[model samples]
Target: MALVHLKNAGITDPTKIDESKTKAVRLASEKVGKDLYRQIYDITFIEKNGPRIEVITSSEASAQECSMSGVDVFVVSRRLGGP
Candidate 1:
């Protein structure tokens, strides 16, 4: 048996960045972390399965899980148009 049994996974085509991205990795990580939390609550994505399954998990909880496993999960997000 294998971990992360991904199958038929797909992602949208890459798009060009139209806005300036932040250079701070920490800020990007923070934004990504929050966005992931939103995605979990919003169920933004569905995993491909006989019966489609909504992907839901807490970003904080995931971080803790990774820590316990001696791994790290970084949710980095780059953005545009900011003060």
Candidate 2:
């Protein structure tokens, strides 16, 4: 399984996430379940300025989940790290 990092630009509001994303992840899990690992959220700092929220998932489907949420995604890259 490959780790996917999804970065997006939007206001840091927890309540504004699309419900379809949550559903997508749930449905995707039923198919490619075990491959999907953990998910982490962070904020990126550009030029010592404000932060942009990022969601790092463990698979392409997971990245799609974030995209389905209607957030303006910037990048989705594979994660390189130890388990």
Candidate 3:
């Protein structure tokens, strides 16, 4: 399993994020990495109007990580070069 970063692309209010919830998400990601050095990526927060995150992994896993992080993911249709 690989780790992927997910950005918020349509978040109207990032400040509305629950601190504890956010922390939990981070912790979970960390735990996942502890067992397996999954390729981890950081999700950068952009403008509130256009919340977007870029993940460096398979789209399927990316979506799963996003769901676990409590973030809605809108993956752009494209193919990544790799095996």
Candidate 4:
């Protein structure tokens, strides 16, 4: 599971999600070396002026990995939560 908190308004433009923003949505590993990783999933905008922002995660497997595996993938921006 993974969670991300943004200090500012995140890019909502589907066409503007360049390399930098796209790189954040992934998992890291160290089995072979430090910080080794793979792109497990990708994010895309389906509609404009959505009610709420969403982050979608996917896993390639036949069965669920854990009971609470995908329960914590969320984003919290400072704009919604005052300091």
Candidate 5:
């Protein structure tokens, strides 16, 4: 996503910095990057403190949302994995 970040920042009419490296003011006004490695913590949290809770992601839950309404609620976030 470094490329995405740079592409976003380069659009802001950069003077000193490379235009291709920065995004526009509107797009670059705020930046949020994910570390993409939080599934371990999420799974651990659920396993250590289970509340009959089945932590799942959007993609996972999407396949079973309607069927899982009575059981699991899809709270999609940065992390989700394990049994």
Candidate 6:
């Protein structure tokens, strides 16, 4: 998967940001199931003025699950040399 730095995303308007969040949630719900979304809430983050997401998880499976569901995630575990 490719990683995108937040600053270069080019979205700054509040309405568009909210729209993106809504679309992300909808896509995730359809692709990953609404029930499972609650299960992974600890690893997900949606912001208003800043980076829209900041997903950090220790589980590769969970990260991949979000990725397949169209949510960007970052896996940081001891196995990957993360503290």
Best by TM-score: 4
| Candidate 2 local lDDT, residue 6 | 29
True-structure RMSD, every candidate: 13.4, 12.6, 12.1, 10.8, 19.9, 12.6
Better of 1 and 3 by TM-score: 3
Model 5 segments more than 4 A misplaced: 11-36, 39-83
Candidate 1 segments exceeding 4 Å error: 1-49, 61-65, 68-83
lDDT of 2 by residue, 1-83 (tens): 11112212333333443423331122123334534333323323222233333332332335445322222233323446855
Question: What is the C-alpha lDDT profile of model 3 across 1-83, one tens digit per residue?
Answer: 11122213432344533333221122123334423323233233334344332323321124345433323333334446854
Count: clashes, candidate 6 = 0
Worst 10 residues of 5 by lDDT: 36-45
1-83 per-residue lDDT for model 1 (tens digits) = 00121222332111221113312222222224632321122122222322222232333224434322221222223334855
Indicate the residue-level lDDT of 75 in model 1: 26
TM-score of each: 0.18, 0.20, 0.21, 0.23, 0.15, 0.18
Candidate 5 global CA lDDT score: 0.24
Pick out the ten consecutive residues of candidate 6 with the lowest summed lDDT. 22-31
What stretches of model 4 exceed 4 Å from their correct place? 1-11, 24-60, 63-73, 78-83
Off by over 4 Å in 3: 1-8, 23-36, 39-83
Q: After superposition, how far is residue 74 of candidate 4 from its true place, in Å?
A: 1.3
What is each predicted model's overall lDDT from 0 to 1? 0.25, 0.31, 0.32, 0.35, 0.24, 0.35
lDDT of 6 at 3: 25
